[model samples]
Target: ANRLLKALFLVKYVDTFKATPRNLTVLVYDRFGLDLTGLGKQVQEALNLLEAQSYVQRNGNVYEYLTNEEQEIEKEIKAVDVDSAEVSSKLFRYLSSDILKTNKLKYAKNGQDFSFGYKLDDVPQGNQRELTIHFITPETSYSDSEIAAQSMGRDELRVFLGRDKRLLADLRLLLKTERYTKQRTNSGATPSMQAILQSKQVLNADREKELIERLRQAVGKAQLIINAAEIPSSSQDAVTRVSDGFQELVSRTHTNLGLLGGKVYPEQQVAGAVQSETGLFDAATLSALNSPGTEMESWIITQTGLGEKVTIKKIVDRFETKPYGWDLGSIEVVLGWLVGNGKVALSVDSNPVVRTEVTDLIRNTGKHPHVVVAPQKAYDHAKVAAFKKFCTDFFDEGAVPSDPTELARFGKDKLAARRDELNALVSSSRYPFVSQLAGVVALLDEVVGKQVDWYLTDFNKADELLEAKEDLIDPIKSFLNGQQAKIFDETQALLNTNAGNLGYLPTGSADTVKALLADANAFRGNKMNQLKTAADTLRGQIDDIVTDKRAEVTAAIDDRRAEILGSTYYANATPAAQESAIRRIDSILARLGGETQAALILQTGATFEQDDYPELLSRLVEAQQGGDDDAPPPKPMVSVKSISVPDASGVLESQADVDTYLAKYRAALVATLNDGKRITL
Candidate 1:
């Protein structure tokens, strides 16, 4: 026990640290060169004695030397004969428990040998269990290189060589196993050890050059996988060697290995340097690992084929798992590319999403969005081209759009603008013929404005509808060109004719024009014919009015002439008197003929009145017959004294009585004047 304790303290002193259980065990074997056969019981006895005396404290499998009597212990260890067979066997047993406790291996003592196997629960199945046995012989050396080399030959070796060369070798073995497991799982066929090691030997690199060369080969393999998956060239840096001599492969490609999945593990530790397995770059395992964009497209197509209504959340969930494990940002970028290219259709709350809006929609979790394959019709090149041509021809300011989203924008922004323009044109006061279009304006509103508006939320449907409704352009053009233009010309012609003939249209004819302008259907279909007939009728009415006015004026002139010629005043007159009266009547008739139809009618009544032209003609005749042209006519005096007062106050009690009184007064005054007699009021 003193010898073993001195060895423990010596190891700590030599290594300048506390001795771990494995360290103590390794030191005993190196120093004494002991036969490790049948040593477990003797090693337990030494530990039990040292622990009872408090010379050492046991922490897990490590014996920590605790004695203050270091000098005495060292002196006793120096005096003892550690080379004796019995003492050697006891020294062997003294620290064998350390190695035994450090592992889950079951040991059995033979005559001159110890056999180690896995504990029952830890044992591999069938023949693998037989390969797990570790034999420590008299010639065995407990060194890292030896243990690492030994562990490589056994497939079922499960020992953990903690912080030792064997740990690195085991880690390499673990990487190999992971690669093999992934290959077997993917291809369902076991890869030979020779094949796995042919690229680079396993647990064989002892120098920096070999390790660096291995790292380069690993990177090359990872690049092949990345290339096969069609990952962007920028992602080639996913596996790269840093300045620190460690190769780190980023785990962007999520794949499952038995022990290395979704984690950063040290693949091999050499010369204080570590190689980390940050990703799975095995091509066979990553055979299903496609580029994010391509994988997402395939997923959507497959889901659609399965009759599944795939949501954005569902896609995020799918890609965020094994095999295609992608970050949310990566998923969004790929999804946007697919949608922008018209490969897939995206919608939020049943409203279609355009390419530019996909990123925001994906980021906003509150919006539940669905994805599916875009309809072929929405992107049909022939249909899209035809529709673009239609838009270019129909709209005055139209521009050809490239995709469904741009087309939707055109319909909303451009087509809507055009519709408003048409509406303004029809409703404008400058184009009074717009009233002749009947349902043309309404039709434009429906097709150009409201129909496009209805599909604004759905870019694909909007694109499809715009393509299918190209026929509406021609009819709208025809209405503006044929019916509206023709009616304007015809109506203006009629108004000009009326202005030339009668100076102004009559009140009834003006009202007819107003009604035609007011009725929206007045010039629609057969109504257009009716408008022409109404215009013709208006023209005819003006002509008739002019004719009747002229005839009336003619009659007035004839009657005045007859009055002067047939009267005794003109018959007994001199020829000069007759000529003078005839000249005066002809001058009045000529003045009436030059006036407008309305003015002529007004002047006809006045010109033929006895107090007007006829009175003037009579006076002219009298003057020509030797009568005084300026003689004052006899005046009859109106005297109130000669009239008797009718009780006007009594009769003027009401408005009717007052009116009757006024009528009598007027009659009496007129009668007095006619009789050439004096009358009293």
Candidate 2:
């Protein structure tokens, strides 16, 4: 069997020589008509005989011809005979130079091995499993930093190239031929408009780079302005420029922190901003947000040093260890101490207020919001001063409202002196003045509103400022009835005489439509005052039962003011939660509104807006909707949106066939070459 196979192979080899003259080996000529009868029996026998002879054997080992130098000549013959040559170069170029511009490749003059660009992302796929995509990567991994950058680059590369193996393999060849891979993804003297389409990547890369650099700069600038920065957003457009000029300082800030600044949770952080130590001490306190027994004491114990009596001092000490340590406010310390004590006990404080709080507001309450409403003491003082001035305005220093001649008789020198004296204190001592003036005016308004009441007719008739009398209403109604009767009598007489434009004069004109219809059915309406009286009787009675005006007002003002004190004024916040509530009211009323930034800065303790502001917030969509720059602040409504899913869906796998299969395929194809001989599949 070995001799017959050898003879047949020799016959085929002679045919190849007869067909074309060339210096060739036996394997090259015997490329065709070389297969034995049955692959199992004949190939096995040939392999055994070749092994026994050991004289330039034709076959190797037990496995299929996946690889062997002896067979390489045949693969080369098969590849050329079967395919178009030019398509390979075009596809290869696209894969290498255009699709995956490698970092390592350099010169076009270099050979194939030196030329490169085959992004890891461009590698072909192999194995598959549910929730686990499998791929064969290079045996050696890159440095951690390089790996990170390359990962990003590879991710982007995969996006650019349509993750296809055949395309990338062709691209790898192109990259080798062009010897180009670097910043220039596609570099040519602008290929023909048609060529550019073929290499749109080369054309588009320039734009992409510019765009990327601009994006980086934008993020950098935002960071700079946001960090170590001051926004000159002012009321009245007032500016206090520094020596460097506002723009110059801003540019400096941008250089320092802007371009580097990112989200509070930024992807890449800069070693910038008003510097502070990383070591921070954690503490816990009660919160309004949590329900009774809903919160865990374990969180607090973990944060605070676990011990029997975790004292307030221990927590403070931890924070103080860092340079520029943040001072825990008294209330915070107290709350922390309370919780520490509570933690030591078995039962949790079930009070709504004592639940472990995760918010900042609970720790910093008590600060006041600035407002025009002065303390009651100041109000009373202003009232007292106002009474004397009111009296003096209508009279002489003797305090009389009547006898204007007697008042005029007072000397001009005395009057000027008295006026000057009163005016001087009216503002300085806003006391005994503003309130009393308002009180008198309110009383006047009350009397004017009851004009129809005739219980005090004499007073009303004598002076409009007084209440009406009872008999006055009867006389007025009678007189009005008589006048109405007389006018109708006269009108009937005139109508009978002339009858001018009878149809038009039949009744009232359309112009009186609104007035005619206005109280036509007033008796049918529900008495609005009845509902108000009922409501006020309940709520006001409830308020009255609380018998502590000072406590009520103090608590309200204290809570609001405290909230204001620490406000960052970022669009999303609480207190003056909406644009309407904060700017229109707070800014106008704030003493340092112009100097401050960050919405809450206008309150008290806070200053400028911190990009990473952590103030508790509630939303106010309706109130914020119509707010103008100078409009009053809107009320906030606490709202939230959430999605609950048992599990999040993700790309468990790209359904990818990984690199190992592709490399094996390529190697198998390459190995099939053998001395110019071909193997028909």
Candidate 3:
């Protein structure tokens, strides 16, 4: 018990002075006059016992002294080192003040008496004698108190008696009862005992109460408070009484008034104990908290704005765990306050109600609920404004916009209008006529080609315009088809008429040949190049018929020539007659050489006879018996003389001789003629 007191005294000494002036053993030996042989072991034992009691904890070689307040089963107050000069000085000043003093003062210099609130006339004379010593009241000291509680343990330290009761009690006693050593002295020597002059007189109940009230007021001004309930009722011996009662209360061992900032622990439970992670209680609590169907479930989604409802349990679960570290009940209270103040809107149907009915009923329902922080309206307005701005810019820039909205608004109508205009332009006649086709091509280039690029991105508009342009083809096609059909029908009719006329041309109709030739000339003269698709075909058919007819006519004319040349009369006739016949055939050929129908007419007119004349009448004297005509014999031939002339010029020399020869020649001729016989001259 004495050792415990010594340890407490040593700790108190170090705490009060902020320095240790001597070693433990030497200090104990000097103060208590103990033998030093085994003092080290005794001191160590005492320190160990103090540590076991949690009165002083050793950190390495340094010891931290715990106050009686820190030794509580539930609450603990650490013995905070008072290294702050301000705190220490302030404590010193308070303890030295008049409230703690129980002493008196008498003072004077020279013949004047020292007085309170002295006037100038009461000033001491110069170089006066020393102030006289005055008797002071005796007071209890903290060492005596410590000795009084020598047998006490933790309970003795529980009640705090301020710095004056703990450390400055001896000083207070010294100031209260001390007196000057010399009877007469100079002012310089008298100043050594000035503490006695500053000492407070014994405080009466009213004075103590007034001082405490002032102290309380000062503490309040400083944002501090004293626990007056811890103060004992006894005035004369209040410290001892409070200390004893606190010790007795602690000794019961079952009462657990928790320490500051800590929960009330069970009796006999050690402080700062470690618990298992998978302990039944903790595991069960975690299981309940983490369960999917539990009330805490989906709370994360709610508070994080991932889901709709913001319930109290969700708020608590979101904040009161992991990073936030708030207690559940504290979060509940905060949410309750918010709901009451209408900062948050909550659903009433939640299992555990968040706020009271009165508070919820008083909330304004007309205003929008502050659910999730968002800017939906602002975003929508901005989007529309941007769209409008883009549209305005697009038009103002002289560019066509191909956005869907722009296309829907303007492109479709523009295309439709363009289509209507094109329809009107081409409606009068077929487009792409030989004369107007170039202009149509230019229009298409200027209109569709220039504007199609703008609507390229808006495919529907492009397709509509393209469809309109495609519609332009139908009219030209229809016109060409009609023209082609007309040309085909006309050509077929011409071919049929010419063929029918040429078919009968073998009958030698001149008009048929003339009309056929006229039609051929017309067909050849009319250029079918400008005609549409069927023109070449019609021309080819007409040309084929003309060629065939010419061939037929040429063959017929050749046959007529052969027939005329091969005739018996032509063969037996004079050259003149044959020449006339040839001239006539040549004339016919010249008239219709290439004219097949005319030549066919000539060929048709000429015919070859089977026989030139019918057989002459039949011969009557066909058969006669041999020698039946013997009685019709003719007379014998008569003899006649003939004159002979020599050959050449010498033979007939004279004219008379020649005359006689002539007469003879005549006579012989007559004789030969009369006798029906040949005469030689």
Question: What is the C-alpha local distance difference test score of candidate 1?
Answer: 0.46
Error of 1 at 359 (Å): 2.9
Q: Rate the local accuracy (lDDT) of all candidates.
A: 0.46, 0.29, 0.35
Off by over 4 Å in 3: 1-432, 449-473, 481-681
In terms of lDDT, which candidate is stronger, 2 or 3? 3
Model 3 over residues 1-681: C-alpha lDDT tens digits?
Answer: 255445555665365432121255454564565656677677667665776666654332334455553343101112222233333333334422433231112211111111111001112222232121110111223343443343242221122233332123223222222222111122442453333223212212223344344433332222101111222334334323322333333323212111111122221111111111224224433232222212232343344465455434445445433333333333333333333322343333321122223223222222114322111111233443343344344223344432323322354345345445444655553222323333444444443433322332323233333443344334334444555435534544554545544453334433332343333122222323233223344345445655665556557656645754675434555566566556655665565545534334434333211111110000001111232465543222222222243332346778987887777667656655676443211
Model 2 lDDT vs. the true structure? 0.29
Residue 67's lDDT in candidate 3: 51
TM-score of each: 0.35, 0.13, 0.16
lDDT of 2 by residue, 555-648 (tens): 4434554554454433334335554445533443344323212222223222212110122232333323345778644433221111112232
- Candidate 1, 580-632: lDDT as tens digits: 76777777777777665555565565545634543544454454455575775
Sorted on lDDT, highest at the top, how do the candidates line up? 1, 3, 2
lDDT for 506 in candidate 2 is: 26
lDDT of 2 at 327: 26
Q: lDDT of candidate 3?
A: 0.35
For model 2 the local lDDT of residue 52 reads 40
